[model samples]
Target: MSDRKRGSHRRVSTSPWKYVVATWFAGVLAAVGLGAVSPAGAALRSSLGLSTGELAWATSSITAVSAVLGIPAGWWIRRLGAHRALSWGLFVMSVATVAGATAGSWGMLLGSRIAEGVGYLLVFVAGPVVLTRVTRGGIRSAALALWGTCVPMGLAITAAAGGVLASRWTWNRWLALTALGPLIMAGVLTAVLPRLPRAPVQHPYRAVGAWKGALRLGAAYGSLSLVGVAVVMVLPLFLTERREVTPTAAGTLVALVCLGSAVGGLAASWLLRRGLALSSLVPLGALMPVACLPAFSAEFPLAVSGGAATLVLLVDGLLISAVFAAVPAAVSRAEDVDVANGILNQLGSVGMLMGPPVFGVAIAAAGWGAVAAATFVFGGLGTVLLLPGARTSGTGTAHGVARSLDAQDRVDVGEESEPLRKALDVSRPNRNRI
Candidate 1:
């Protein structure tokens, strides 16, 4: 290759890995900010004199805003470019986290969380889009799989730390301290990350049809969020109430379960490297939870039950990672990624909005078994919905291959016919004399 070409190639490859890491780091901070509330829910409740429902509102409010504003956020991200979107998102999250720290009333905290949700949506939408742009080929799949770990890792780190910290310090102080993380990350991203070019203006009407498949995948993916939110939000409470563990122990155990999800993400990456299809992975994800939930919810010895629960959550994490892997697989066009991610984020918000409260209600009405049953139902439905789409995806791939082959055959036939046609033309030139 020419020196100019080599230099250009080197320049393109230089910063992508850096960009991927920074973007993923920003995502982790956002996840930490989102999860900082879960383990501290009890502390916040007592400190602020909140009722059970009000406590749930602290977390669900974020999702509520996301669900409502998700689609619009996608359009906005497309307009703003990924770098700017992330910077703004991190800034908003920092502000909201501080607001939550200083909240004087339950209502104030809820409102702050609502705002934080909007910030989280911005980061969430832009993170993958930026990652997609920076990475290419096999690296993109692995990077995305690794990207799936951010949420669970953030949840685990914050929940584990929050439990220990909240035990020593006031919840407000804990919140205030953690608020610095996203603030710093936001500033760093604004200063260091290169800005992405704006996406071309697309007609909204034409884009809608293209988004339908992504929307379906997003909905199916969202259903798993319901399962995830239920597990993360309720597991601590379940352990405290049903398993007779201390609040701190319950929090620690919950953190362990969340950590399992990080491992699951890595495992999914390994699977992708081995050439497993996203469709096969999705059903495995759905069914593993169904099989494990019973063991997790059953009455066993503490050690045995804890181990079972961890296994269940580990599988759940793997499934969540697989769902993320499916996102890029579902959308064929590059431009559609942001919109599809937006739809996924929005539906995920809906699931997050509903999951915890619904689980709480179910647990109240029946018991942990009810929660288990609910998870099974959702998982099954998600599996059923996902299979048809997976089949369609597979069929589309086959048809695309067939079309390529048919086109190649036509080209080959045309080349062979060219010589024959030329010879015939030379022999039949007397026709011009007529």
Candidate 2:
């Protein structure tokens, strides 16, 4: 290669990763911004005079909207390009989040959430596309892991921080502080994200057509989201209202779940290195909530309940994080990485929609324990869905392998009668980087 070409390549490689980090930072911002509200949902509901169903609708409406909009958002990204789409997403989310602080009515709050949901959908859809296009190999996985981890980490940080601030300051201040997360993301993106390359019109077309795949991935994503929100969203209320735990302690329990999710991401990175099937973790993820059921049901004292809630959430978090990490890896495990990712993300949006309602319904009817039990059922279904199909082990195969396929050996059987070949020329993996 010419010196100029080599230097240019080096610069491109470095530049994309910077954008990847910035985008991942956006996930954290959205997570923190949104998550900060969970601990206060009960209060918000009272302040707004919302019914249980209305509160549930208002609480989960954002995720549901994100799920519904994710595909369209992906299509839009093709026109706007990843960087520009992401910038617009950040700006919109920042404004929406700040506005959420001042919402006095159910309608106003729901509207704010809808806007945030649209932003979340766009940010998530575009973020991965940019990362995949810019970085290769281990960097791809690392970038993804970073993105996956940011959600829980942001939730943990924001929940704890919000609880602390709300205890001392006013709720508006807490909401205003949460807005900072997105504003910072917008600033960073503005500085580092480059001008977007033109997107193809066909991008949305392909994404829309991947309906079957999107359904399957969405089922999986929904299952995961159901369990995650059950723990994160409901548990805080469960502890406070049902268990009579303090807000600080409840926040700590939520933080523990996020902590477990962070660790689970690291563990998943390790498992991926070992060439383990994504399906292997499926059972564990399914079982984590079941494990929580007993703990949640037991009539333990406050200290024990606090410790148990933390422990259960921690385990479930690991499982949930692994589930989150697995979706991208599993989708990428397909030869049609782009389509697979698009579909997977779309499904995740569906999952996000389903999780809150399920949790809220269970909470309203049978209480937190019932919600935990319901999570076990949903998670078990997810495990069954992830059973391995016939595919190469992580080799990027062409056939629609259903089994616990590894990324390296994934086979892609295109829609014609041809032998499997390499689909996307992704970066080669470096096992040592994890």
Candidate 3:
């Protein structure tokens, strides 16, 4: 084999962290479109003569596609290869952004957002697979943990940048500018991202035999989304109404708080590097609802509430990282990684779609106090789902995980999946710990 081909086959292909950075960056770019619509809503509505409901759909349409196509997207990514899928996803996002920029009507914009959704899911679902392929041991824990922060990071960036851009250039022109980022990033990844090592190709997928561990983790994620997305989507309005904060200030506060999710992601990795078992971190799941209690309640002072909100967000990030890091340990075979991700993606997508509207209805019926109630139930369910996988050997160091591509070859998971449905085992500890 040629030197290039031979090097691509190395266990640690290229500079793994650079690949992690590239994959994670691509994920963040995909998430921009998810938040792009919400900030641009008023501008788009005025420009296109659309309704509030129409505007809501425009923002959610990307999430809607994820809920519907998430599993299949994973299956396709499995066949397509994670590295190439990311590249294709980026190119697709560029085209979709251009379509939105040129759109003159709600219909046109919605179509563009849907296309972006397709691109978005491809990038999101495929990312972890790539991260796991490139790194091992404790660093693998940290890398996957870091990957979980992409969505919050992207949204935070967009929330801060989107309003400014929309004000300066108008929404469509703003979109035109953001379009170049992915195009540039895609080229950067082609050069900087490592080629994935080869593995046995699984035959055409059968959706029935999802790993039970993944199912529980995915369900936990969905439950967490029920609370987390509600808090995020509703936070600005909550602040504006509850504390009389200005729209811009509330948006800024939220954007900054959202970035705290990264701290949580890194924290999960830190715990693992210190020789913490994945299951022992179960109480860490309390980060969201515990913080939400005060943040969502009127009984607390504004300072206290805001502090709680920040805590919830940071913990949410930590849990998400934990799940992504744990996913490999959740499945028994290395080849199953993408499929397990599909399961998590599918369920998590469901939660993202459901969180906002459901929270809205609950608050309407019971008042702000209801937000705490709903989050408590959802958060408890999420915590419970992560329990089964934490007590095993799989929850330890990466080399200890037995679920590599071929049973004899140990790949790195480096443990820690609780934040993510145990996402980061991704399955039960003893069964497939890698």
The most accurate candidate by TM-score is: 3
Per-residue lDDT of candidate 1, residues 150-218 (tens digit): 888888788778777877888888888777888899888876665555555566645566776778767
Per residue, candidate 3 scores C-alpha lDDT tens digits across 1-434 of 36544333332333445667778889888887678777777888899999989988888888888888887887788788787888888888889999999999989999998998888888888888877766656667677778878888788888888878777778878888778888888888777654554345656644455477778778877887666788888888888998788987888888877777766666777777676776766687766666778897778887788888878877777776777777777776677777778778889889988998899999899988887777777877887776665554244423455335324223222333112222222222223212
How does model 2 fare in lDDT?
A: 0.59
Output candidate 2 Cα RMSD.
7.2
Selected candidate, larger TM-score, 1 vs 2 = 1
User: CA lDDT, every prediction?
Assistant: 0.71, 0.59, 0.74
Error of 3 at 314 (Å): 1.4
TM-score for model 3?
Answer: 0.86
**Residue 376 in model 2: shift from native, Å?**
3.5
Better of 1 and 3 by TM-score: 3
Q: If ranked by lDDT, best first, what sequence of candidates would result?
A: 3, 1, 2
Cα RMSD (angstroms) for every candidate in the order listed? 11.3, 7.2, 7.1
Tens-digit lDDT string for candidate 2 (1-434): 36555444444454445666677788778777657666566677667888888877766776677666655565566666666777787788878877888998888888887888787767777776655545544454455545656666777787677666766765556777777777777778877664533433433333444444334555665676567655666666767776777876666766776676666665655564455554465556545665566446547666665555555544444444444343444442232343444555667657665676677877789765686677668767655554431112234531223122223223333343121111122233323321
Runs in model 2 lying further than 4 Å from the true structure: 1-17, 39-58, 102-106, 194-199, 203-211, 237-244, 270-280, 299-346, 356-373, 387-393, 398-434
